[model samples]
Target chain A: MKPINEMKLEFVSKSSNESFARATVSAFIAQLDPTIAELADIKTAISEAVTNCIVHAYKSSIGKIYITVQIFENGKSIIKIRDKGCGINNIKQAMEPLFTTGGDERAGLGFAVMQSFMDKVRVSSKPNKGTSITLEKNIIPRFIKNGQPS
Target chain B: MDVKIKLTGNTLTACIEGDIDHHNAKEIRECIDQKIEEESPNLLELDFSKVQFMDSSGIGLIMGRYKLMHILDGKLQVINIPENIKKLIKLAGLASLNIIKE
Candidate 1:
C-alpha cells in the first residue's frame, strides 16, 4: 500500500529501546491529532511489540530491531516491528495470555495487550528465520462541539 | 522509573513516576519488593499519579507485588491509575480478580 506518510527506524534490541520505539511511533502518529486515549493505545501496543522483540526474539543478546510505520490519508495506520532473531515456533500459544517463556518476570501478556489496544495484529515467523508483527489501527476521526470535523 | 515510598503506620504507599516496561520493571519490582521486606506493611498502595506510560510489564509488576502482599497476609491497592493505564489493567483481568482497588 502506498502510504501518505511513512517512517522507518532501526535500533539495537535492548530493553531500554522499548520506550524509545514507543515514543518515536507516538510522536510520528501525533500528526493525525489523535485523542490522548488513542495515542496511549498506540504507545502501549508499540511498547509490547518492542519488548517482545527484546525479551523473546533477542533473548539478552543484542540484535537488530526494525520498525516501520505507515499512515494513510484516511487516518488508518499500519505499524510493523521485525526482529531477525529466534522465531516463534507456535504463534497461537505465544499469543495466549499468561503463557510466557520469559520466566516469572514476564506476564506473558505482550501479544494479548497488543491485540487489545490495536484494531488488528498479525504475526508471522519461521523457526530460525525471525518474527514480524504487523499492527493496524483505524483512526477515530475527531470532532468539535459544532459537530464538525476538527 | 523513579519510586518513592511513604510509610505511615502499617500502610506503605509507593509513588512511581515515568514509564513502566520490561527494561525497568525489574528495577521497579526489586525496589518495591525490598521495601516490602523491610517494612512488612499491612497495606500497600501504588500511586500512579505521575506515571505517564505503562504496558503489559506494568501489569506484571502489579501482579508480582500483589502476590507478595498476599503471601504476607496484607492487601494491595492501586491508586490514581490514569484512564489509559487502567484500561491495560482491566484488559489483564486484574479488576475482575479484585487484585487492584481503583
Candidate 2:
C-alpha cells in the first residue's frame, strides 16, 4: 500500500474556529484535484463533524479538536476528527435521525448529513474518554473523450 | 449574519444572509420560530437569495420550520435558493417542498 499524504490541524472548540478547520481541510484536499461538487461535499462533511464537536462534545466545556487528513495516491481521502471532551454513551442512538438530546430546536441530523455527503463515515466513542469520527471518500476519476483518465 | 423580515398580508418572508452552518443554525432557528409564533402568519417564505453557504444545519432549520408551519395549518416556501444550496436541497430530496427560484 502506498503511503498517504497526511496533514494535521488542532484548534480550540470555538464556534468561530470552525472556519479555520474547514479551510485547512479544503486547502489540503485541493491538491487532490476534486471537482466543485466534491469539494462542497467535503466542506459540508467537515462542517457537520466540527459543529458536532463544538455543540455536543464540548458543551461549553473548553477543549481542543484535532483533525487529521490523509490523501491517498488512488484519490481516496480520509478525515479523522478527534475531541477530548465528554464522550457519547449511546453512539447508535445518537446517530439516529431527529433523535436529539438537545431541546426542540436541534434537528439532530448531524450524523445523517455527514453520512449522506461522505462515501463512508464511522464513529467510535468511549464514555468519558471522548469520541472520534472518521470520514472517507474516493474522488471519481475524470476521463477525457479519448478514454484516457484526466 | 443578516436577517430580513417582510410582511405581506398574513405571509412573512425571511431573507437569510451569510452561512447557515452549525455555529449559527440554532440562533436562526430561534429567531425564525419566534417571529413565526409572534406573527402567526398563514404563510412563511424563506428567501435564500443572499445566503452564500449552508450545510445540513440549514436543512434542519427548514425541516423544523416545515413541521412548525404544518402544525399551524400554514405553508412554507423556499425561494431564490442559490445553486449550491439547491443542489443540497435536491440531494436531501426536499425539492418537493415547493422551493422556487427567482
Candidate 3:
C-alpha cells in the first residue's frame, strides 16, 4: 500500500548522525502516537541500522547514508536505510548473531536486535556496490491496547 | 555518553549517563578501562540508573567490560538498569551476565 506520509533524509555516515537519525524518525513517527515501548523499539532499530551503515558500510571513509520512512494508514512504519559503500560479501554471515567482521568491539547483534523489535527486517547488499536495510513495524494505538477509557 | 567514576577502595562504580550507542561506546569503554588499569579494583559495577537509551552497542559495551574485568581478575556487575534497557540485554541473551535484578 502507498504511504499516507513519508520522508527522505540524506546525511554523511557519521556516528554522531546515529542519534540525529533516530530522533528525526521518532519525531516524524510521533504522529502515529505509539506507546512508549513501541517508540523505543523503533528508535533502537533505527540506531542499529544507521550504525551499521556508518561502521560497516563505510568502514574506511565517510560516505552518504540515505534513509526513507513511510507511514501507512494501517499504522505500520516502513523504514529503508541505504549506503553506497562497501557491501557485505556474505549477507547470511552478517545477519547471524554474535558474528562480527568488525571484531570484538562490536556485539554483532545489530541485525538480531532489529529483528527482535521490527515486524520485518530485510537486508540487500552487493559487494563493492552498497547495502540497503529495510525495517517494518506496526504501531498499536494506546486506547485499543489498553482496552479501557483513560 | 559519559561515566562518573566512584572509587571506594576495592570497588569501582561507573555511573553511566546518556545513550549507549556506536558513537559513544568507544569513549565509555576507554574511560572505564583506564580506570580499571589505574585503580586495579577487584570489582567493577556499571550503574545504569541515569542512562535513558541504548542499542546493541549497549550489549557490546557490557560484554567487552565483562571480558575486561575477567581478564583483570575482577568481577563486573550491571545494576540499576531501567526496564527497557534491561529488555534489550535479555534479548541479546546477556542474562548470563546476571543483569536482571537479583
**What lDDT does candidate 2 reach at residue B78?**
90
TM-score of chain A, model 2?
A: 0.93
Task: Give a tens-digit lDDT track for model 1, residues A72-116.
Answer: 877799999999999999999999989999887678899888998
How far is A17's C-alpha from truth in model 1 (Å)? 0.8
Instruction: Select the stronger candidate by lDDT from 1 and 2.
Output: 1
Sort the predicted structures by lDDT, highest score first.
3, 1, 2
User: What is the descending DockQ order?
Assistant: 3, 1, 2
Residue A8, model 2, lDDT: 88
In model 1, what is the error at residue B13, expressed in angstroms?
Answer: 0.8
Per-residue lDDT over A1-150 for candidate 2, one digit per residue giving the tens place of the 0 to 100 score: 553689889999998877778878988998878887788788888988998898889997979999999998878899999998899999999998767876665667778878888999999998778899999988865563236956
lDDT score at residue B45, model 2, on the 0-100 scale: 95
Better structure of 2 and 3 per TM-score: 3
Global local distance difference test of model 3: 0.91
Chain B, TM-score, each prediction?
0.95, 0.93, 0.93
Going through the candidates in order, the fraction of native interface contacts each one reproduces equals 0.75, 0.40, 0.80
Off by over 4 Å in 2: A144-147, B33-39, B71-73, B86-102
